[model samples]
Target chain A: MNLVDKQLVKNKMGMRLIRNKLIKQLFLMATLFAIIILGTLLYRIFTQGIGYLDWEFFLSFASRFPEEAGIKAAIIGSLWLMAITAPISLILGVGTAIFLEEYASKNKWTRFIQMNISNLAGVPSIVFGLLGLTVFVRLLEMGRSIIAGGLTMSLLILPIIVVASQEAIRSVPNDQYEASFAMGATKWQTIRRVVLPAAIPGILTGGILALSRAIGETAPLLMIGALTFIAYLPENIWSGFTVMPIQIFNWTSRPQEEFHYVAAAGIIVLLVMLLIMNSIAVFIRNKFSKRY
Target chain B: MLTVERNRPMASSISPIKDNSIYTVRNFNLWYGADHALNDICMDIPTNKVTAIIGPSGCGKSTYIKALNRMVELVPSVKMTGSIDYNGQNIFNPKFKVEELRTSVGMVFQKPNPFPKSIYENVVYGPKIHGIKKKQILDEVVEKSLKGAALWDEVKDRLHENAFGLSGGQQQRLCIARCLAIEPDVILMDEPTSALDPISTLKVEELVQSLKKEYSIVIVTHNMQQAARISDNTAFFLNGEVIEYNKTDQIFSNPTDKRTEDYITGRFG
Candidate 1:
């Protein structure tokens, strides 16, 4: 064949070898970049911090330096915060979602409320902290203890929970709702029986992720005047408390090298907790994704 | 088993009784935004019999059925006039409860949409909503309804299993059982078995035959044979109007209107 014929007969993009080679190189490079980013984060966390994760460190309370610093109070407080935050936010979010999805007629105000909720979820966490300081702690007169912090966290996570709940409620096939409706079921009956049960997996994943966000929250609690030094277990919601993120923040910001080690241990604990939460989120997601 | 085997199906049998008219639709006109979907139609669905409304798709068959239960009122742009009188009371009356009407006039969709729950829960859902909380009562309902749908023997052991885990046929049966549990006055099926296999279709058709003894059934089906097989009274609808409505055997064998005959003969649907 002539040069013109040979050119036309080759692959459309280019020569076969050239196209294949470029694609393979692109794939490898993309993968390599991902691994590098992940590796950097992992290396920085482990090499700098894993050495400080000993039994003595875990048993200690927060101090000026690594020698006396521990995350016991912070750990316990976070657990308390989560215990209060998750269920309350879940109930409120799911309630709002049901109202919007099932009952609310399409109107300008309802749509505006729904749209702004999603927007609120994306708002900076620090803004929520400031707002919480103004609203819950100051205006409502709830002091900046675990309770106040938890209520603030609830608001911070509420938007995301609502949006997540709406998604869960929406994911239920219209057929299931129709089936329940056709079964002489009232609107609430249908929702409680068919829609809620079907959307449970979706709701659970959203709820867990929302709780995870609550666990990672620091900015809101800090601004709400969360105590930086709570050495003892929190007795009530109104008492002074310190969350794990605050402890990590307190340590990481300190100039002393020894304090950094304490921060590392805090980071490790937070990471392990996050890891467990994330795995559960993944398990639920996979389970529902398959069955649903 | 009242066989009117005459060339012309005795129209005398049309309004046989006074108190038996379950849903009396009088001059029903419905509009969807600008389109006049249902045009001044009147229909009487007798109690305790399967009334199949057969027509080409988009001929107001589904719309008219939905209107009877006030479900069509759910759409924002839908404007409906006239009343649906059920058992001497207009269901669309402002004093009547919408939720209660919907509960009484139960519906089954074209697709098999069992709640993604256990077979037991799916059956018990309606009664639970109506406030039947006693375990013994609910258990009896679960068994009776599933048995009513011809599914108890197959699904009794798998009560706790998710309804989605069932085959499509079983899921459809579960939906029917779910409806039956409420013991509604009228049951509306919008092409319930159109999504199933022939065997599944037969099961549903048989279920319909038995259901008519307790509940007035209004069904919309695309299959002419299915209408002929299961329906006692048939209404042939075209262009949102009832072309011919008479006994099922008459509609299939000898329709009074040319449009109904053409539809049954497959010249046009």
Candidate 2:
């Protein structure tokens, strides 16, 4: 080959290498940027909140005095809300997914319902809170109880669970169904024995994600008139409740300097709860997820 | 000395087949929306015999076998106008319970489709659904079924392990054992060995041969030699029609039709 041709080839190779390196560096820079922001937030939260994160902070009730404030009521309320939301949403979501995926014939009406559900997932959380206020709180006369709040949160996250569950159910191979049916298994039997077991990991992963979102949600609960300063744990589903986010919101909004530290501590508690739940999700997914 | 029937109505052969037949398909025509998938199919599948249906791809061989178990109904747009008599009952009749019909007619697929569960669970799945709740009975059924499929020795120790952990051949055998556990009178295999290695294919063929003594076996296959090796009766399907159906020896040795001869000789599909 001529020197000019060789030089051109060399230039092209050099350009390609440069381009590859540039793209790799760009992606790496983006990742580093995300990590830096996350690290900064975590560092700030820990440094600001570490002092306030102790037994008294967890055990004491919300009080006018910042030092005397605690998240006992908030923690219990969040757990109660979750205890209601998780089962209701999971049952309704998984049932809807099964009905849509297995029983319902593919038609225009089903497609319309599916499309609306996906749309519902993207709707602002505040809108669901308003909906809860109108329907559960007023129309239904649920009166801003834990049940009302839980039901509202369930509605907000139901779409996400349904979508995730549909994906999980849909991912189950048709061969499994066919094999089961060929063995004279009824539709319910096949779903119970084959489809549900195969889809459990995915279903659980979805449920965890939905519940996590529900736990972090403050807007809907606020709109539904949850108290910012509950001193006692709710006795039942019908009793009033206030979750961690609202308590944190209450603390952060106060003018006192100590309340900011308390808010940061509450944030830490919420993050840990989310971490625990997500870890369980990951465990279930890894433990049970199958190739086919 | 071999009687080869060509384009004959199924009713004429019913008298001879009725005594020994497990499935009598008469004028079985199926349509997937506008496309004719199985056209005027008529065949007598005998009891305790391996009947292999051989055809080119998309020639309705698989469709026909699936029809035997009424699995074709799973397709939404599929329509059929025919009578499939299984044990003196018209399966196409709305009055007939499909689940009951399927209980007597089990199926294995082209690929090894174990239920993403342990081998023990896969085997006991059918019996459990059928209300066989006693643990002792299930254990007995699992052992008997696995042994019957000639897979007990290989999988006996690892019965609790996920079935996907097993080799492809073992998975296929597990599927067979699963079918056997249900104690179905007939087993429809839609190219059961097509996805396996040569060794696995041979193992499945041998199992099919042995399985015939207790269960009526209907298989759809692209592999002609597999049919020759295992099936007692063979049917050559072409363009949604059965071109020839006869004893395996006669069909392979002296196929009456020109198309059947061409197909077996690899002249053209």
Candidate 3:
């Protein structure tokens, strides 16, 4: 109502607008900082590695010389490791999730178990490697084999998958469960027919992310004593193996400048593999979401 | 003796329920944790007839019906005492399996809940789980059940289409057809038409009338007129107690209890 008060209100409004713009700029800068760093890293990798990524680069085996070195053995070994890791972790993880979600009552013991599982996911991966060394390699006599590495990787990612699966199962509408139960469906029948189908898209997304993490993991494999210079592909679950990360790690640490370029090429292959896996998961999730 | 009288409350009589009764509930009480959801419920649900339960919200009508098939046990903290006999066998007996009780008593909800599957698959799901796997038998069951629910003509050509593709009323009918596919003796509908349009409600009321000729139906409805229109017997529940159980005409026209009269006349819920 007064001239002085009106001017004060106008000044306050201007200051508030200035503050809002400043915060918006700050957030924009924060976002762009991450994007720019990632973009620069990608550009560097592509430029450093593109010359080495030829047909022969995928077909030949790792050699003493960088010019002749390839990731064929490492690629095959990683595939073999994943072939062992994916099923074991997924089945066990999903099974545990269903039991906890559908069957268990809400009690202190189950809550404790749930809390510990979440904590287990945050534990350092090297601890799992030590466990694998003591249990799988040394105690169980599985000694530096693909199965040892696969089992270690599985333990590392099992918590992530279980948590993801529990969320998926929980997200299914209560009405769906009630409908199935009213039809005289036993618990198992209802789960098999209704719950699993509805939750598959979410479960697949989690499992793929876990698997991609398993693929890129180097510390656990190194701790389990995976060979860093394997020139031959693994023949079976029991055979000694070296994955792409181990090969890349070895190349990056070598004295030769050419080996660092080779390491970049190996990183590109790993990224592509992760991209392919993630794309398949996204495709399946979209198809299921649309259908349902 | 000129007309069948389902008028008397079961507590006032010493005689056993008639042999034609599909369910005999005696002094049944249910608690959700510490909340008394259903208190001292006593009634007889007649076979091959429509029984409508009319009540205000939280009056235990849905709880009582769900207890008939022991579906109330799905809630973790539910506690119950007293007996509900389905076809002369106590459903709560340890020897009595829940699966068998549910096989005979299927429920439809207030909301249309169709499985996200093909219409044919949805119909066949109950029978398929019950071990009727032959294609010929499943096909016949689908056809008969869909026709029984009066949903065949609209969905017959699109049996393979997902059940979610249908409208709400069609989906409700599909759920009914799915229930019928199991060939259950009783169908428990919990306010099935509360979510429907007037035309759809009329269609479902007609279906319920026709359905009772083959299967016993117990429907809970908030709409007083709908209960009077579709039900042969009506029970008026208030505050988790059945205030009156009688023929539908008498309940609407001459409710013996003042509470039932107050509820039906819309003075207060």
Candidate 4:
């Protein structure tokens, strides 16, 4: 038979073929859209911000105006924030996740709490700002203080931290629990020694992702009353504080073009910090997943 | 063709473990959600004997064994109306803690589920939970249980290694050692070697035969040959009912129930 004449060709659409084409087209579209958006963002950031970087930018402290400024106070503010937010959020978020996963019996109340958490995750960051302002700042009367800002940020992202932590803890296989029980270990012992170690990497990844989000948040801080400009370093919880985002906002809002360049410098520093946080999260995830 | 194979004490004319003594079950019924899982199970387990429950799939043999220590309570939808007597007391009594009861009657699953921990930690995990914090005592218990399971020599050199690193046979032996360390009254095994190769199956079978010297054992297995080889007493369950109970030799050679004989001879499942 000849190659062209002896073969059959399909002219009708099969359901499977239509579905396959849809899936392939969808995947290609998503990938291309993601790459394009990411490229644009990186290009805009690097072009405006890259040339503004210098040795003095890293060394000198912030000024009331961008005419005499660096990110020293802002960087220190971020470092201090990490010191407070990381441990406090970790304890509360991981504890709540474990409680929901392990000890909460099947009931409507537990379901209600779970629904509230997911809804809180969906709630806008600025809404949390209003919440923190009303509850933590004005209601508590801890006004314009660094601790108030940090604690307010903690409240803002607490749902994300808890939700991600719950997912991490739940990913552990049920066999591990059964194995520990069969070996006559108590419930607390099993959780403390076996389940926690197995879930550590996942928990750390969730935590770092959440903390990165907290680092980028300025709307909540603004609502909770953060000082945009500060000359002196904060030594106590009640001292006035200014973070990198507030510093960037202060510089960018000025009438001078030089101030616009300084805002670019602050954005660059923030990008590098967020990058390091993401890298640490990926590293921890890989390390523990291998052991498990 | 069957020979009586039981350890008889010379001074005792009757087996004290029998004659309405030891763990007694009376008119037990269990349900999983709306499905009746076990029905009307009436039997007594001896103090120091291996009781093998053999049956087809969905026959409630596994359900009956879990009823011994109320391990069935863990399943959220499980409900039971039965009195399981352990040492002349109803195991379902209000004061009995489920944790304590489970500790006293340890269980091994069908698959070898070793902890993601060192071999030494797997053995010592039990004692540590029971408030035995003295390092010296925990050391003794780990060594003794590992030696009893016949795994000490092979795993002794690398006691600190993760248990998942071991072979399947070694891991199953490690699980048995884990159960043995708590000093339980009865050890319940649910198809302990169903997930292993023939070699690991044989090793676990041999270990079960020797284990009866210290602990009462109840095993649920689908393999007829394994029941014939390792158990002292045999039970046959079919469709959530006890079809027959007899000595092991009688079960393999001459079962009273036609269903049991048919199952043993491989005529039908």
Candidate 5:
């Protein structure tokens, strides 16, 4: 090879190797950055919260003193809220999904509705709180009760559940529907027996995700005036309630160092609850997937 | 068993009732939106016989068979004219319920699509929907239908297992068994063996032949040899029209139409 050609080849090889190394290192650094930040946060939370995460922390009611405070009332309130939110959101969300996916005609109106739902999912959760404040709290006279808070949370997560459910329902194979129809099944019969069963795993997955969001949501519930200092469990749907995230938010806002530890402890509890819900969702999905 | 006799004269001259014609289609035409899918066609499908519709891809054979059971209407903007008479009743008539008509005219698709359910549930799905609730009756129906599809011996022990556990051929046979559970008067097969291996295709072809003894079967197949092997009568469709339809022997051996001859000889699609 000529001297110029040899030098040119050398330069090309060197550049290629250097570029590859640079790109790989850049990606690795990006991933490590995320892991380091997350690791630090987790380490801090565990260290600060471990001492406060005992049975007393769970059994005692919320109090002015950080050492005496517990999440007993908040835990019950969160459970009550979920008991209302889960069924309402699941039924309404799945119903909307079925109507849109199976019944609604694919036309301008459906596209318009679909576009609006996607947009609703992106809108700030606090906006839903305002809407719920007006509709449920003032107009409906629900008045900051657990029912009002649950309804607000449902509205907040409704779009996510609907979109998730629609995706799930749409993923069911067209062949299954055709097979069911070929067997003398009506539209309703096919949907009930084949389409819904096949889509249930996806629906449950979406529902669990939405419920997790509902559990962690404090802004909407706070906007709806859920009390942060309730000492007793809710007596009925009409009774006011406070959830874990709100209680933690209340603790972290206090002008005391010890309350921050209590906040970290409350965060750990919320995380565990979310983990349990997610595990149930995964179990259900796997069981149903194996069946088909 | 029906004899596989070749060179038998066409039964066109006999009255449909005497000849046991289960379906008498006349001047049937179909359009999906502006595109014509099936042209004006007239044919007679005899009861207790296998009639195969042979065509290349998109030649409208599947559309014609779907029209027989009123399934063609499921597509959006589908328009049909003329009549398909099933047992002397026009299936498209306003008084005829599509669901009731479908109950007597079961269909199997190109893909073996068993519901994501247990084998027992898949088989008993049809009868159960029509209100056969007793477990004893459902068990009997499941066994008889599986036997009818030649799948009972293989699947009897695993009836409660998920239907997806079966192999491709077994799944197809399971679908056939599911169809049989309803005890329909006719079974429509839409290229039912196209998705299977050679051995599985042979198994399905044999099952189709055996099923003809009990139910009138209308099959659409791209495989010409499959049509010849399983059908008593064959219809050659090209470009949304039936060029010639006759006894299977004549259609394959001495097709009157030049187009049918060219197609059968594989000169062109």
Candidate 6:
């Protein structure tokens, strides 16, 4: 090649390398932007709330005085909410997933149902609150009870669980199904014995993540009329409840600056609960993934 | 039984005929949606012998074996027309239960697919599904089935270990043991040793030879020498049709059809 042509190629190659580096730096910045925001939020919450995370802060109930406010009632209320939401969502969700994957024929009608389910997962959480208000609260006359709020939360997470469970069930290898069926196992027997066990770890991971979302949800419970000032634990499914998010939301709205710190403390508690639930999910997935 | 004796006929014939036939497939044609996967096929699989189906890829050898136990029906779009009579009962007869048919006809796949459970549990899966609840009975079944598959000694001490822990060859044998636990009369193997090492392949071939003493065995293989080595009868398939069927020695030594001779000679697949 001539010297001029060689020089031109070198210039082009240098430009291309610079362009690649520029795009890589741009993507790196985009990722770091999200991490920076999350880091700042975590830093702010931990610093502002660490002082308020004493035993006394956990023992007392919501008070007009931020110094006396606590999350005892909210903690119990969130637990109660999960007690109802987890089983209802899991049973209904996994059942629906199994039916859609295993039993339902791949026809126009099933496709229609499948499309609607995917659409439901994207529907806003507040819209589900409105749904719960209509169906569980006013229509059922359950009155601001834990069951009413829990059922609403279940409805909110049902689509998420169902979609995740469907993916899990679908991921089971066809060989497993064939082997089970070739052994004279009936459809139900194959599903119950082989499919369900193989799909459980996935189902549990998804179901737990969905349940954690329900625990952190505020707008739905608020719309369902969960009290912001409950001082005692819910006595039954019919009893009034106040979850951590609603309590934290209430404190954030207060005029006193001290209340903001209390809200940060509530956020810390909620984050810890979510972390523990997620850890359990990871544990179950790792344990079962190794087996199969 | 609803006998449809007027089904269209196919051309291939089995020679050196035996009196006791486990499966008599007559004009069996299968279609996956609009695509005809298996054309009219006819063969009499002799009882108490290893019958091998040899074919190139996508020639419907695997499909033919799957059809014996009605496992092909699992595919949503599959449609079949014709009859496969098993022990004098038409398998496709509406009155004949598929579960009962499967309980009598077991299958081992090309890949070793033991369940992600204990070795003992894998062998007992079929029996448990068949409603054998007693632990003592299950223990005996596990031992007998493993022994029958020639896997008893290798896995005896580690019966409680996960089946996945076994070697690939052992896993395949465990699957055979699992099938034997159901005590099926006929065992269908779809390229059972195709995924194994040469040593493992020879072991499985020997197992098949031993297994045929009691259970009727029908195997599909891509390896021509393996067919000659282990099978009593061999059927050559091409383009979804059975080109020739005869005694293994006759087919290998003196193929009747020109195409069969070419396939056997490795001139063309």
Q: Chain A vs. true chain A, TM-score per candidate?
A: 0.91, 0.97, 0.96, 0.89, 0.94, 0.95
TM-score of chain A of 5: 0.94
Each prediction's Cα RMSD? 4.7, 3.2, 3.7, 5.4, 4.8, 4.2
Which consecutive 10 residues in model 5 chain B have the weakest lDDT in total? B5-14
For B1-269, candidate 6 gives per-residue lDDT tens digits of: 22322222235474447668988888899999998999988888999989999988999999889999999998889999988999989999999999999998999999999998899999999999989999999999999999999999998999999999999999999999999999999999999999999988888999998999999999999999999999989999988999888889999998767778889999987
Q: Rate the local accuracy (lDDT) of all candidates.
A: 0.83, 0.91, 0.91, 0.82, 0.90, 0.91
For model 6 chain B, give the 10-residue run with minimal summed lDDT: B1-10
lDDT of 3 at A146: 94
Segments in model 1 whose C-alpha atoms lie over 4 Å from true places: A1-13, A20-24, A287-292, B1-19
Q: Give the per-residue lDDT of model 5 (tens digit) for B1-269.
A: 22322223232322223478999888889999999988887888899989899988899999999998888877889999988899999998899999899899999999999988899999999998898999999999999999999999998899999899999999999999999999999999999998999998988888987888889999999999989998888988888987778888888988866678888999988
Pairs of colliding residues, candidate 5: none
Two-chain complex of model 3, DockQ on C-alpha atoms against the true structure:
0.62
DockQ of candidate 4 (2 decimals): 0.50
Tell me which of candidates 4 and 6 scores higher on lDDT: 6
Error of 6 at B228 (Å): 0.7
lDDT per residue (tens digit) for residues B1-269 in model 3? 42224344333421123548989888899999999999998888988888999999999999999999898899999999988999899999999999998998999998998889999999999998888989999999999999999999999999999898998899999999999998999999999988888888888999999998899999999999999999988988888888888888888998766678889999997
Query: How close is chain A of candidate 3 to the true chain A, as a TM-score?
Result: 0.96
Which candidate should be chosen as best, given DockQ against the real structure?
A: 2
The regions of model 3 sitting more than 4 angstroms off are: A1-11, A290-292, B1-19
Q: Candidate 2 lDDT (Cα, whole model)?
A: 0.91
Q: On a 0 to 1 TM-score scale, where does candidate 2 land against the true structure?
A: 0.95
Error of 4 at B168 (Å): 1.8
The residue pairs that clash in candidate 4, if any, are none
Docking class of 4: medium
**Model 2: residues >4 Å from true position, as ranges?**
A1-10, B1-19
lDDT, candidate 4, A77-153, per-residue tens: 87777677888888899999999998999799999999999898888888888987887678998777777777877
The candidates, ranked best first by DockQ, are 2, 6, 3, 5, 4, 1
Off by over 4 Å in 6: A1-9, A290-292, B1-15
Chain B TM-scores per candidate, in order, are 0.92, 0.93, 0.94, 0.91, 0.93, 0.95
Candidate 2 lDDT over residue span A1-292, tens digit each: 5557877787799889999999999999999999999999999999999999999998999999988999999999999999999999999999999999999999999999999999999999999999999999999999989999999999999999999999999999999899899989999999998899889999999999899999999999999999888788899999999999999999999999999999999999999999999999999999889786
Candidate 1 lDDT over residue span A165-276, tens digit each: 8998887876666666655567777787667876777888888988998898888888989888867888877788888998899888888987776787788889899989
